[model samples]
Target: MWIESTLIAVFVMVLLLDWITLIVHCIVGVGLAWLAYSLTTEAPRLEHVTLIHLPIIFFAVVLGTLANYVTEVVRLEQERAMLATAGSIAHELRTPLLGIRSGAAGLRNFLPALLSAYQLARENSLPVVAIRRSHLATIEGVLERIETEANYSNAIIDILITNTRLPKLGHEDLSPCSMMRCIRIALERYPFSVDEISQIAPVTGNDFIFEGVELLMVHVIFNLLKNSLRHIAMTGKGEICIRAVSSSQCNQLVFRDTAAGIPSEVLPHIFKRFYSLPATGDNILGSGIGLAFCSEVVQAFGGTIECSSILGEFCEFSLKFPRIQS
Candidate 1:
C-alpha cells in the first residue's frame, strides 16, 4: 500500500509539478506511510492497507484535479520569499560570481608571464614542479573557459530569478534606454559556448530610446536569446539573427532564428504562462516561463511582441515599442 501510494505521488509530482513538492511530500509522506505500515502490521493487514489506500488515492485525485491549486500554493510561497528579498538573491549571487570571474581573469593574464619565469627558474636548475608540454598547452584555455563559465552562470542566474517577477509594478523604475545598447549588453553577457555566438548575426543598425528599465530590457533580450538557442540546439542546424529598427513611428527589435520552427498547433500558445510543451528531439518546449516573461515585460513597458514561424524553417520574434523623443 505504502509503495503504491509513493509511486503515484512521484508520478504526479514529476508530470505536473516538476519535483519540488516531491521533496516535502516524499519526506513527510514516507514517514507517515511507515507509521501507517507499522500500525497495519499490528492490526488486520488487509483492512489497514485498505484504510491507508483511501487517503493516498484521494491525494492522487486531488493532484490530478487540483494540480493548478497545488501549483498556486508553491508559487505563492515563492512570491512571498521574493517579496522578502525584493529579488536581491540575484544581486547576492553576483558578488561571488564576480569574485570568481575576476580571479579566473587574473590567472589568465598573469599565467603566461609566470610560465616564462618558471622556465627561467628551471633553466637555472632550481627545484620546481615540472610543467608538461601538454599541461601548458591546455592551461590557458582552461582559465579562459572558467571565466567565461562564471560570467555565463551569473547571467543565467540573474535571468531566471528576474523572469519570475515580470511586469514589475514599479512604474517609477522606468527610464529612457537605448535599445541597441541593451541588446549588446545581453549578447555580451549571455553564456554562449564556442561557436554559439557565431550563430547569431549582428544587431541591426538604428538605435532608439524607449522608456524602460535597462536591466529588464537586457533580461528580455536574454529570454529571447535563450529560447532561440534552445530551438537551434534542438534542430542542431540553424542560425539566429537580431535586428533593431528605429523610426519616428515605432522602434522595433527583431530576433529571428532559423530553427526548425514551432509546430502550427503549438504556435498560438507560446506566450501562455506555465504552459510548456514536451520536448521531442527537435522542438521548442523550454523552461516555459521565458517567452511568457518576455511578453509580460514588453507589454508592461508599453510595447508589443509577436512571433511568426514556419515549421522546419525559422522562428522570429518582433518586439515593438513606442518611439520616445530624445
Candidate 2:
C-alpha cells in the first residue's frame, strides 16, 4: 500500500508541479512515512525494530524538513524579487506618463493663445506680429513630445508583457522588415530630452531586410537606444552611431555608442533576467529586464544579438540575421 501510494503520489505530483519540486515533496513524504512506520508498524521484533528505526527516522525527518525549509525560502526570495521588479517597472512607467502630461500641458497653454491672437486679428482687422520659429517649434515639439512619450510607454509595456507571459514562439506571423526602417522608427519614437537627439548619427543607404516582426525589432532597438542614451547622459561623453550593413554570410545592424561603456565583468550578465545596476545620482530608475527581453525576442525570431564594450570608450551591439539569397 505504501509503495502504491508513493507511485500514485509521484504520478499526480509530476502532473501538477515541476520535477525538482516533486522530488522535494517526495523527500519530505518519505521521511514522514519512515517516522510513522517506526511509531505504528506491527513488526514481529517490535521493540528491537522500533529502536533501530527511531534514529534513522529522526535523521530522515530532519533532512526532509530542512530541504522543505530551503525550498520555501527560495520561493519567498523569488516573491521579494518579483516585488522589487514590479516597483522598478512602475517607476519607469511614471516617466512616460509625466512626459505625456507635460506635453499635453504645453499644448493646452500654447494652442489657446495662438488661436486667440488669430481671432483678435480678424475681429479688429489688426496686424498680428510674425510668429517666432521658437513658437512654432513649441507646437511641433509638444506633438513630438506626446508621440515620443507614448512610444516609450508602449515599449516598456511590451517588455513587461514579454517578461510576464514568457510566451514561446509558435506558428504565428512573420514579415520582411527593413533594418533602416526599424532604426529610424526607434529614433523617432524614443523620448529624448532637449539636445539629446543631436548626439545620434544614423548612417543611411545600408539597408537590409529580415524575416521578423517590425514592432518587436523596434522595441529591441528601443532597449539598446535607451541604454545607450542613459549611459551617455550618465558619463556626459560619447555619441551614438547607428548603421546597417550586410556581409556575404549575414546582414547585421550595428548600434555603437561612444560613451562610458559596460564593464567587462558585467557584459556576460547584462542579458540575464532581473539583473540591473544600482541607481546613482539622479538617474533614479533602471531596469534589468530590457536586454534580457531583447535577447528572448531576437532568439525567438531565429537570430542573434551580442554586445561588447570597453569601459570609458564605447559599447556596441550587433544584431545579425540570416542573409537572403539575392
Candidate 3:
C-alpha cells in the first residue's frame, strides 16, 4: 500500500509541472504578441486587439504594412506640395521676365537712332569731323547685338512661363472647330516652314470645344510642333504628322514624328518636370519644361496623355480629352 501511494503522488506532481509549463508558455507568447502589436500599430486600442485577436506573426505583418502605407502616403503628399510651390514661384517670375525682355528689346531697337541724333547735334556745334560715322556704325552694331540678346531672353521667358503655369479649365462650348486652322495659327507664331507643317494629317472634331484654357492648349500643341522642328532641323530629314478624331468616349489628338524616338528607359519619365533625355544636346534651347506643362494641361482638362516610341523609328504622343456634350 505505501509503495502504491508514493507512485501516485509522483505521477500527480509530474502532471502539475506539465500544466505549469504550458501556462508559462502561453503567458510568454501573449507578451511577445502584445509587444509586436504595440510596435507596429500607431495607436492600438485594447478593444481593437480583443476584436481581432490576430496571431502574433500576422499582427506584426499587418502593422508593418499599415506603417509602410502611411509613410508612403505622407511622402507622396510632401512631394506634391513641393512641386506646387515650385510651380507657383515659376509662374510669378515669368510675367516680369517677359516685361524685362520686351523693355530691353525696345531699348536696343531705339538706341541707335538716339545716338545718331546726339551725333548730329554735336556735329552742328563745333567740328564737322568730331563725330565719326564709323563710331555711330559701331554703336549701331552693338545695339543690334543687344537686340538679339533681348529677343533670345524673351524666348526663354516665354518657354519658362509656358512650362510653369497651372492648367486652368476653360468653359465648354462644344462646336466643330477646324483643327487644321488652329494648327496653322499656332505654327504662324513659330519659325517653322510651310513644308514642315504640310506633313501633318488633316483633323476635324464635332464635340471639339475642349474644356481647357485656349492658351494652355496652344502651348501643348506648340511644344509638339517645336520638338518636331528641332529634330528636323538637327537631322535635316524628318516628318511630323498630327491627327485628330472623335472616339465614343473622348476626342483624340495624335502627334507622331519621324526623328529618332525617345529611349525605352527614359520614356516613362518624359512628362516629369525637369526630366530631359541626355540625347537632347546642349544646343537644344528649351528649359525642359515643355512636356511637363503639357502633362499638367492635359490632366487639368480631365484627359490623358501617353507616349510610345521605337528607338530608331518614331515617337508618338496621344492626347485624349473628354468629349463635350452637344
Off by over 4 Å in 3: 1-53, 57-62, 70-74, 81-109, 114-185, 188-207, 229-239, 246-250, 272-293, 299-302
RMSD of 2: 10.3
Question: Cα lDDT of all candidates, in order?
Answer: 0.77, 0.72, 0.65
lDDT of 1 by residue, 219-293 (tens): 988888888887777779899888888877899998899988888898889887656666653222254567878
Alpha-carbon runs more than 4 Å astray in model 2: 1-166, 279-285
Cα misplacement distance, residue 245 of candidate 1 (Å): 4.1
> Residue 80 deviation, candidate 2, in Å?
12
By lDDT, who's the top model here? Answer: 1
- State the lDDT of candidate 2 residue by residue for 102-169, as single tens digits: 77777777776876777678679787766665776675566666766666675556545544443566
Report the poorest 10 consecutive residues by lDDT, candidate 1: 279-288
Q: What does candidate 3's lDDT look like per residue over 1-326, in tens digits?
A: 43345334434433443434434544575589689989999996677544453354344434444555666689768756755665566557667666766776787778878787787778688454565778778866775555455554555455555665554454453233444455566655644444665655554443345666665677688788777777766766667877777777788888888887778998899787666766667222243567877887788777899999987778899998887777
lDDT of 1: 0.77
When sorted by TM-score, best at the front, the candidate numbers are 1, 2, 3
Selected candidate, larger TM-score, 2 vs 3:
2
Give the clash count for each candidate: 0, 0, 0
Q: Estimated TM-score per prediction?
A: 0.64, 0.59, 0.56
